[model samples]
Target: MLKLMSLEIRKHKLTGLIKGVLIANLIILGFMVLVLFVDQNEQVSTFTSFGDVFEGLFVFVKAVFIIFASALLGRLVIEEYRSNTISLLFMYPIPRKKLLTAKLIIVFLFTFCTIIISDLVLGALLFWINHFLQIIPGQLTWILVKDELVKLGTGALYAAGIGLIPLYFGMRKKSISATIISSVVLVTLISGGFDQARLGNFAAISISLGLIGIAIAYVSIRKIETDDIT
Candidate 1:
């Protein structure tokens, strides 16, 4: 599987995506700074504490990378099928399922790892900025850091699974636009909320949606051999 993944990465020239991710992170950091600035101008505090800042960081990371995953999926899977280029891959000696699975794994791992690393880096940077600006009140304690780390890990795990949900829509229409748009809709639904209550904050809902994404991946791989690429 690793071998196939390596080949897929090279074959698709996915290294470019790494650069794209970096650029995206930088943009996000700028947005975070803007948010802090906005918070200062308002009478009500948008981020009352470090915990709230971390939560905002998670929401942004999750929403951005999930869309990134879908775009990757569109390029890796949906576009191939749409162009009938996947038929050439199926002719290779490797099993069709393995070929497809390798692509999905790349998307999943990329989404999961990027969110964790980006969150930590951005969180640290935000902390430093806050130190000078005094934008948010409260001391950053070890206990809070530890708790945020836990939240980051579990959130990344759930996001990795949720990232695959777009595959269901992508496969249905064999359209890259459909794939990305579906992901946007999914992210909005999860991240949207009334005040402090977000749908994604509910552990049960996250778990359920994540399971649905995983099941979609399984079914997609199972039917790969039978799918017509001609």
Candidate 2:
């Protein structure tokens, strides 16, 4: 598994994937800053704890991470099939399932780590700015800190897991465009539901989507064995 994952990492080294991830993070940071400026009054009036600020940040993070996963899946999976490079990979001694598993694991880990880091960095930066600027009114108590940490960890996992749905779509269709487009549509619909339902919590919804992504991944791995490479 380590060897396969290493190989997968090397494959993506020159693919601009890392660059893209960095650019995405920067964009998110900029957007967060803009929101802080525009919603200063609202945040000051409504937010009572760190969790409140984290929740708002998470909404954007979740959406951006989903799109990031779709792009990675396109380059790593769909592009391979589209370019007929997967046939070349099949000629290797490695089992197709293991190869695919390595790729998926990389995707999950990459997405998971990126989200976690981004969340931490942005959360801290925002908190620091708030300390002096008083943009968001909240006390960073131990309880609030612990709760936000748990949320951040679980939220990253949820984003990574939900990403597999687009991976499954890309693998099934071998279409990069389909993978990206479907991901956008899925996130939009899910976000819309949350907006309308006013559930005020995304734990249940995220978990449900994560489960669906797992099921789709299982189907993808099973089908790959007999899937036509021609």
TM-scores of all candidate predictions against the true structure: 0.97, 0.90
Residue runs of model 1 more than 4 Å from their true location after superposition: none
TM-score of candidate 1 to 2 decimals: 0.97
Each model's backbone clash number:
0, 0
**CA RMSD of each candidate after superposition:** 0.9, 2.4
lDDT for position 77 in model 1: 94
| Number of the top-ranking candidate, with lDDT as the measure | 1
Highest TM-score against the true fold, candidate: 1
Q: Where is the poorest 10-residue window by lDDT in model 1?
A: 221-230
State how far residue 68 of model 2 sits from its true place (Å): 0.4
Model 2 per-residue lDDT tens digits across residues 36-102 = 6677657344344567677777767777888888888888888898889999999899889998888
